[model samples]
Target: MTDLAPLPLSVLDIMPVDVESTPSGVLRATLEQARYVEELGFTRYWIAEHHNSPNIASSSPTVTAAAVGGATTRLRVGTGGVMLPNHAPFVVAEQFGTLSALYPGRVDLGVGRTPPHDPGVARALRVDALALDFEQQFAELLGFLRADFPAGHPLQKVAANPPLTGKPSLWVLGSSENGARMAAHRGLPFAHAHHFSPQNSVAALRTYHREFRPSEYLSSPYSIIAAGVTVADTDEEARFRNVPAALALLKSLTGPPEPFPTPEQAAAHPWTAEEAAWRDQFLAPQVAGGPDRVRAQLADLLERTGAEELMVVSMVTDPAARRRSITGLRELFGSAPLPQGLAL
Candidate 1:
């Protein structure tokens, strides 16, 4: 058995916009939370991009990455990730290259092929959205980042500016076997989206490890598992806190997405048998309990996945509750501390 020693932890924030909160308010909260987690000794903080989603405010992760990077001294900031087909590879290279230039060694660029929006919204963003070949786009993006355009390549004359001081660490995000193979083939780090697609997590990770090759960025395979979590003083309280996010995810699948509901709203919700079952199934992979229970379950998860790192996403609606959960996690995992009162 692998030793149950503490592993590296990070945060993946979707910046869920509550009904009463404005986009600006969500952004502010995210920045503050990033700083707080940095104090808790989190290695990195990542934001996701989602378009046309009422509940999620992070439409531009590059912009948010810059904000979070500027606010904290040591936390590595990145996207969890940017949907590459939405924009030109050159633009992404320039944007992340600029971030690397500003922050030096504290920048990361995680890329994915999944479109965050539906077909119509995707067309609004790019006229030829449906025709995009993600594999080709991904290769082009890497070429720009590495400054390795072939001698006669059309983009050889163009350079991503301001030039990167050092290449930002790259990660390929996926929830499928194909994504795992691609990341492994390229020798980039891989992050599996276990939080949302729990069923495929093990298969994807196994595929990545089997196909991995050593490269410039890493001498061995590195993988991170992104998992959803909710913790409180007791299992009962943790389950209660998770209600809102669970209801929000269910609504997103069945109808138009809404802002995260409050605990009271979730409590008052009229759940049918089917809906209740759906909620339980959706939350099967999540870890929610008091410190001891959470720690044991997380250790089991690490043993099963063999991940080098874990990136957690906690979606409790109350700010104080969220902070307390994060603080509890830090203590549970034995991460090092910052100055007193910083995390609180």
Candidate 2:
């Protein structure tokens, strides 16, 4: 009926290492960016987990979360998700338990099914049983967090220790309906990967709401949707800033990730017919514009998705441009922190 109000915004970063930057530099930049965004009133700062990728430095999101949590006092920090097949359930619980002990009331634990990279890489990651065992392992992880198991269950005795006052707020991260169903069945909050998989996002969120069953964790449905946003002083400049992320993503889909491309490289590259088409599709769901246009696009998206919160992935290659994008977006979320009830 009317324009939707600006949604509560959060941050999701991969600590991208561009062709011009080193992994060490990107890591340091992540800490700096986390503090900056927290000061801007972003609800949270979460890192994505990606491995065997030259462009992404956040190979272990949990550890990165610890670093981010230490760098900022108020922002909730956690994995946008941990790829569950990469680690044991007990170990994941233990790791987050330690984080909760340190951060308390500010940690979030979001998990997803693993994406098998290359064959060799998948083998090296020990994810051979990923597809078959994901649900079982996911269940095991929740059990560890809940500290509840059937009577006489062997896992009952083996608990994830360092028990603390707060358990990390849990979220199920997905790009498809399968994870939605899993999250709904468990009554955990769901976060859809709309930035990468726009086609499935609406369906996934609807599925989550339709099938949701209340559990000890939550009494109602809650969802967050991630979107790629690039804002600048002008629409043309915003498009220029977003080009490198689209190009790097296209390259990664075709083969192993290369160094994240720089804006100069993006400008120099020839846009073939098919590549241009692919880039258009990749950028279609994302928002890239100056202030007025960005506000309009975000409002339209909120009305369409009905997400309680929005997680932003700014895809600017230059560190300064990325920071500008972050700062530019802070106005959309007003000055107050997002109000949330943690289901810990």
Winning candidate number (lDDT): 1
Candidate 1 per-residue lDDT, tens place, 238-264, comes to 888888888998888878889988888
Candidate 2 displacement at residue 72 in angstroms = 0.9
TM-score, per-candidate, Cα-based: 0.94, 0.93
Question: What is the TM-score of candidate 2?
Answer: 0.93
Model 1 clashes, total count: 0
Q: What tens-digit string does per-residue lDDT give for candidate 2 at 198-265?
A: 89977888899899999877888888989988879999888887788889988888787788787778
> Which regions of candidate 2 fall more than 4 Å away from where they truly are?
1-6, 164-168, 253-255, 335-343
Per-residue lDDT of 243 in model 2? 81
Q: List the residue pairs that clash in candidate 1.
A: none
**What C-alpha lDDT do the candidate models reach, one value each?**
0.84, 0.83
